[model samples]
Target: MSGTAHKADVRSGGQPGSVAVISSHVARGAVGNRAAVFAIETLGHPVIAVPTVLLPWHPGHGPATRIVHDNRQFAGFMADLAHGPFAGEIDAVLSGYLGDADQAAAIAASVAALRSVRPDLVYACDPVIGDESGLYVSGQVARAIAGTLVPVADLATPNRFELAWLSGRVLEDNEAIIDAARALGPPAVLVTSAFAAQPGMTGNLLVLRETAHLAEHAAFDRAPNGTGDLTAALFLAHLVNGRGHLEALRRATASVHDVLANTRARGADELTLAADAALLSEPVSDIDVRSVGRRSEDITIGG
Candidate 1:
């Protein structure tokens, strides 16, 4: 009764590409599958939606009942997706919050299985392990994701805390963040809640093999839960649709800022994504996405 249920004016029909989203499903908040699925679908990519866990709402909102399926049952379900009738439909995979530690290995296996059919299958792993406060998931789950998912992913989106835990270092500055992201195994890593160059600003840092870009927007206190989820989904969708790395990072960061501003205006605890779904596809860009470090590597992102 409390979650978003409105629709966006999408493309004429579902687009050609299909993405498999594996994450949590909250019946009453815009987090995990709820946020990612909407952003991806609005961008015109049909989604093979899969829920890793069921919950009433985000834990930040308060206590809610959690329902994690049996490992064997969950494994069989993923196996079905990999070899099922529509197995070939998945063009990409976006993985997020894990309910069980074993789910990581299963998801890795499925990603591998899907890749066999489509060699260029784009897999973006959002390591939903922790936040500034600390690890929300068990140590085992965090390790599993760092080992099984991040290593095999084409891209990874991890918050600063999660990256710190994964790298076993204190990422006190942008240089350290970039260094840790390089060692994070994924060729492209998008670190959310990254340290910004300017004061009172938050940034999303995209650390690529040869380059890095940081897109900063005004940071707000008590922002919604789904920003990271939405960022990962949008960034991956743009890349799958053939946009370059910097372009995708800029667009995704700008869109998230747009929605965050709108949500704040409405005084909503959760992101008002339903009311701003169209913004995901055509975001109003007032963001400054700049190349990080070294003037030689700096490229102007002209309008």
Candidate 2:
């Protein structure tokens, strides 16, 4: 946004790729783009952010004033970014929390446009549709993401509930989650809040081909809302930096785990991402990451 020129091209690896981030923007909390843009930027990538919706704080806190740009305005904004000067530098795109069905189509078009310029542009879609509380968004918005965004995404990060909703299956077990993820059409699918064999933990399951990598961390009650947004952005940034899937998952999960712990320690309602900024770049790996079998039993331990 300043006079700074773009970093060296993504191919040369002189610097990490610039990312185009599309998500909801919250004025006061770390959710959606607020979480994503911070995480990506902290991971040492330039971010071009576009807000699909605006809110004073996370709606989960209570009732709040919000703004969802109509389809026309949002499309125009996305179009400008697609054709903007920095478009050529966007080697990756991370999208989450759509305002409406049309926003999904608009984001898909922009992703296509960016891919036309850079064929290798990675689009990571975090389908922020619902949670255990039931389908939070309108059915139409969820369907649009499942039909439009998920089809075009190179990678998809959906929590267990969203994956279940998208696949029209009851993913009561990790095997069902794996099957649903593979059938959902994304080359890589990371299911957050996945089933955990241990009663007190939760996992982020990364499914690729027949292999599944489960990154398990202690489950905290009443975790903040933006962990999904943060995880998606951090994982995308690590991949754009050329890290492999497992390493990316490990680091992102570790970072998120630390943040959640730190937030809970301070009795804070929001993620302390700003106060814990350095943790994003150098997160301590204290969680359990390992390969899992069809029944989700551990196969190989991560060293």
Candidate 3:
């Protein structure tokens, strides 16, 4: 969680805008900041990367040293950025994988400070708490994220398990997910690992007030980690570039699918994001997006 400033590449061209990404940093793996920063930069956006934690690689790969900064120092560091001269250059903030519960408050402070000057600032929170196995972080960290960061998020990217955990309900189907997402407080919610109508297919569900769109693609077994992180970054990038919600969802999903497929084909444990940078800019994978009618009960699985 230490604050180390990495200079943004001038080659990005900054066509859309700059994004401030707060997340974990792995030295070798394409997860957390490693995934988000590269994806955003590859898509032609300047990125200010704030690492919440530093690790040798994703813990799933093996044991690695984890470094978290002092809470007071982390707070000051975030405040510095919030009030810094370049703060106005940022168009959005995307956060993922907090190192500690206190870091959540620091992030919230940064978000608040930025929003004070730029009322329309976009903040995307990806609750990287856990997966189907259960919560990987302590209850305090989970609560901090749910109570602090999520409340201020303009958009939230939570997988099915996370959405269920955050909403405190069982989401056995898309209808349940949609209900929970609508009530999740964010204007838009992107639920990954969402239920799909057809077997062997997985979808990223984008739920808005009046409608829900499911972007489905072939599910890859043993997909690498950081797909959620990558999704949030790409989605935010597209939106900042003026793409609508549906288009952003489709493009993000397609890019993630393409990256995962490439990772699987290469037999790599992590997403080959660096090698496959073109996928982020122009994903070749086809994603089928369909509108689902709002429901009071269970949503129909198929049209």
Candidate 4:
């Protein structure tokens, strides 16, 4: 088993919100893990990471990352810690890409246990299933997340594809996506990789009980692998910090868009932390928090 710990100075006196991230740990590089750490740290939150497997690099259609020692044992290690130190301290649990359905079930069961201890603990589950093409998680895992985890989640961030899978809804436009989100029964649903009726534009949608707001940045020519992870991390952090779903969505959307912009400006394949981190604390520069509607007079894709 191999791992590395990089610590940052978290602000003192702020509410010490605790978050448990159940996702994979790639020893060398993973934008998702890094984004999760950065987002949580910015929010002055402590995090316990439960990894699926310790790998050298994140295996996907992205940049090559180095692999150190394998820490496949870390998953159980995290689970054990969850039973102990991660008891009442956990204010929120954020889950990302799981290796398989069994892992999803295990995560769901663990979440249930945590909830047993702290009934108010928020579970922000990002059902990392398939994307525009098809399903990525095992069928059993997909089913477990949709059936078990989602119904109990306080907040969920599912990409457009995952939303369709979880709700059995065909999201052709913004209206359909919002309806699908409502069907899932979560108070809030952050849908990434959202495509509107437009021919070639992709963005994110934040659907709440009363409002459905769409935040569209010009779709980057390339797809960044850990984007959803980053979005989920910040959104959860904001929500845990007392920001409502719509506010959190605006902030998260702006933060991710700024990160992508910085990444492109630097000609980097991955996010540019130096420039992007500045936006972490203040995700959206302008927004009317009172109203849950787009302020920029942008065209609604599917209403």
Candidate 5:
């Protein structure tokens, strides 16, 4: 389904709190905006979705057409939203994959503009640069996000590889993840794919101002894309709903775990978010959350 089809199907109840989701849009799969928008809205938050690019499906599944908006037009579109009358309605902004490096500056500008009116706005930046396979995007695009967006983000959700790349170190353990997260400059950093204590589990290590937590769940084989996107959106949504940091982390992790398990059970190629929508609100997945204590001074900078 294209964004058009999604827009037609999703009908919010005119909710008060709305989230601005800026990412890619896939016609047939739930990857970027498709994943974030539905996850946010299902939790009762209205979504203002801005697509950085449009795709028929994720490139991982097969070759698909890519539709990137012209740089000037993209900037104008984002500017209109930022300066528009309803800009203040946005409670939070979650930015993901970018089509071009210039898009990072445009997003930063929009975030800044929104912050001027709503000083307490929560901006979560998901630097979707690459995974374990190394840098997937151009070095320029990665640098643009690191320079223009990451510094301003209230929260950053980066997988282990991304965190390692951003911090200029190899993160081999949770402690290293914590140290790098602290040095990364974001007030709060959610490091996904952190080392799991359990043999068959993976974790999301959340390092905040004064505390660190690890939320672990069973590791599924071949999990679909957009887990990070869904996790970031849900975590922010929970915070906006007044949940404490620990609660938000646990809930968000559980929701993603449940959704992934469901998707796998059905043998679906993409996340079955629509079928597992209820899990977003009432996730039944058992997430083991533990306090990992405060940051440690003994940090190892991996080679």
Candidate 6:
């Protein structure tokens, strides 16, 4: 941040509007890359997601269309980008779920390249790391994402646990979430699994700039993996379309909730957006933007 100048001003070809996502693509499972692709498509943006890791049950049991590559062979894939027509055809970038540090490095470099051509392009980083219990991603990969990838992103969506880990702060409740998000210095923050424990009251908090708003919703009985991907993509799309933070939160939350409800109704494992395509396109029956009021207490930063 010191001398980087933070300049993003470049133009590119190919539709003039698209989102390049950097994350792993699973061929067999409906997780990781498949979720990202679904969310990006729902937001009406073309996606360019490079495969970062390949597992055994891929190509046969995963999403209908998925990019598969060996984790050790990331360089070959990247080298292909440097010499192909894809070198300069990206409008924005949305990244999530890095399997290894090398993958994170590759993604960071690609993000830099995308910025070179699409300077005003919005970069959204979903720094996928650990959940509430413990770290699921390797420490090296987590460090690279927090240290390199996140700082360069214009918008970031990290869950409660990720926020705590990135900020090195203990966040037991809602207020602490805001404090932690502010510390990260990201302009907008969407804490996906926000839970407020104040007796009988329970809700999630969405913070933008320095303002935090709360919305009460029923938490899904089971943890759905792709909810974050959908939330980030929808939030970014709505924000770019001139929707405010709280409004975006409302839309995203409603959308995810509807997806979960549909999944539960069908007794499926994960929230199947494909089954419920309407939820993706029309997250909410109607978009309602309302004032959730200012924080009763201000977040104090120790300079």
Q: Which one wins on TM-score?
A: 1
The order by descending TM-score is 1, 2, 3, 5, 4, 6
lDDT of 1 by residue, 169-287 (tens): 99999889999998988888999999887888899998877778888888988999999999999988887776777777888988998999999999999999999998898889677
Report clash pairs, candidate 5: 1-27, 1-28
Off by over 4 Å in 2: 1-15, 295-303
Global lDDT scores for all candidate models: 0.87, 0.87, 0.86, 0.69, 0.86, 0.66
Worst 10-residue lDDT window for candidate 2 reads 1-10
- Which wins on lDDT, candidate 2 or candidate 4? 2
Instruction: Kindly list the per-residue Cα lDDT of model 6 for residues 57-111, writing each as its tens digit.
Output: 3322444443445555775566555346866655567788775777767776766
Each prediction's number of clashing residue pairs: 0, 0, 2, 2, 2, 7
Model 6 scores what on Cα lDDT?
A: 0.66
- Which has the better lDDT: candidate 2, or candidate 5? 2
Tens digit of lDDT per residue, candidate 5, span 203-290?
Answer: 9998976668888888997889889889998888888776766777889999999999889999999999999999999899767677
- Worst 10-residue lDDT window, candidate 3: 1-10
Tens digit per residue, CA lDDT, model 3, 1-303 = 001112332325534557999999999989999999999888778889999999999998889899998999999999999999877777889999999999999999999999887776789999999999999889999999999999889889999999999999999899999999989998888999998889999989988877788889889887888999999999888887767777778889899988888899899988999889998988997676788745322332321
Worst 10 residues of 4 by lDDT: 1-10
Every model's TM-score: 0.93, 0.93, 0.92, 0.80, 0.92, 0.79
> Considering summed lDDT, which 10 consecutive residues are worst modelled in model 5?
1-10
Worst 10-residue lDDT window for candidate 1 reads 1-10
RMSD of candidate 3 to true structure, Å:
5.7
Better of 3 and 6 by lDDT: 3
CA lDDT of 250 in candidate 4? Answer: 69
What TM-score does structure 5 among the candidates reach? 0.92
